[model samples]
Target: MTESVPPRSRPGPRRGLTERAILDAALRLVDAGGAEALSVRSVAAEMGVAPNALYTYFRTKADLVAALGDDLLGRLDLDAALGDADWRSAVVRLAADLRATLLAHPGVVPLLLHAGFAGPRALVAGEVLLELLSRGGLPADDTARASYLLQTYVLGTVALDAAELPPGAARPDDAARTAERRRALGGADPALLPRTAAAADVVAAYNGDAQFRWGLDRLLDGL
Candidate 1:
């Protein structure tokens, strides 16, 4: 049997510029340009409004950035992400999900680090992570410590991943670059840096996801 699709709702009456509109415009600007491009004047220009008009919604650039961070964090579906997974699995999923979310908006990564995780959504995410850790039978102290460790790992990883290259920079070919770097390291005097020379081959194979999972598993093992 075919199920009928519900009718689309009629568009609401147009309201003049709103805080929501301002935020949307700001996000679009950030997505096109990096965080450095984000400014009250830029967002106002994007919205076709005077720079002073944004003051009605956000008094300063900091305020606008705060609202943008909140909006981004609020998009995560904590419950759905965790699902029926066990505590360990849930924590792993949460960490990966947070990374994925931040990676989606690379411009916001710096704001997340600099502005702090004091937003309502960030607070809720923290509570959920703590609850999962506690349920895993970790002691209170361990749970707190684990939460901080996990958050730090995720944030640092995302921040480094999002770090921008200079204008007109071209990335090198991965296989060729890796081989060249490893060969150079391999040729170093064994007596001076024996250990580094020995590990050069293994170190040259850089796999971001594998490295992240390796570290995550080690942390989980410690817990």
Candidate 2:
């Protein structure tokens, strides 16, 4: 019998896979199943490649998470916000944009918190924030403190917003539950908590956007 010739093997993703492509796949996985679903295996599976294929781009899950956070940070319009604006306005615009972006990808908040804003994009954004504060005439120490406060405020607000709901509750039911809780708080003992009882309506009317703006304005004013 004639000897059979061996078939050619398929090329590995080492040739075709890219960091951008891997980050894109990781974002899709997060969008579908949250950040917890992201892994070398899951991302590779999402891209229809072997798990080892991702090693060409990201050596570890932490690297992938950092890449994901940086990718998201790169999406913000910090350049535009920095241009042609007063420092206060620039800061407000940047903070609002950051919050909106975080809300858009709620699943990535934990990753951002864990990664602590290292990476090129995050650094650029930080530089812009500091520039704004410095241009606004804050001294070096004050500028550093303000930047930290702003970063903390933005990240903490987004984290709280993301963690507000338990999984699987319907929106209307959740709204009703929140309303009931507010009502209960409103009805608390006036004798024990006079200010809370007096401002019950204001307390119960907690609009997130309004609250965020109010807090941001107050912080900026203090700076």
Worst 10 residues of 1 by lDDT: 164-173
**Among these predicted structures, which one has the highest lDDT?**
2
Error of 2 at 121 (Å): 0.7
Give the residue spans of candidate 2 off by over 4 A.
Answer: 1-16, 166-194, 205-207
Q: How many steric overlaps does candidate 2 have?
A: 0
Question: What are the clashing pairs of model 1?
Answer: none
How big is the RMSD of model 1?
10.3
lDDT of 2 by residue, 1-223 (tens): 9999999986555866888889988887776666688788999999898887788678899889988888888888887877946889889989998988877767777777887778899889999999999988999999999999999998888888766543322123335645766878966899999998887766654536667898999999888
Report lDDT per candidate: 0.77, 0.80
For model 2, state the Cα shift of residue 149 in Å: 0.7
Error of 2 at 99 (Å): 0.7
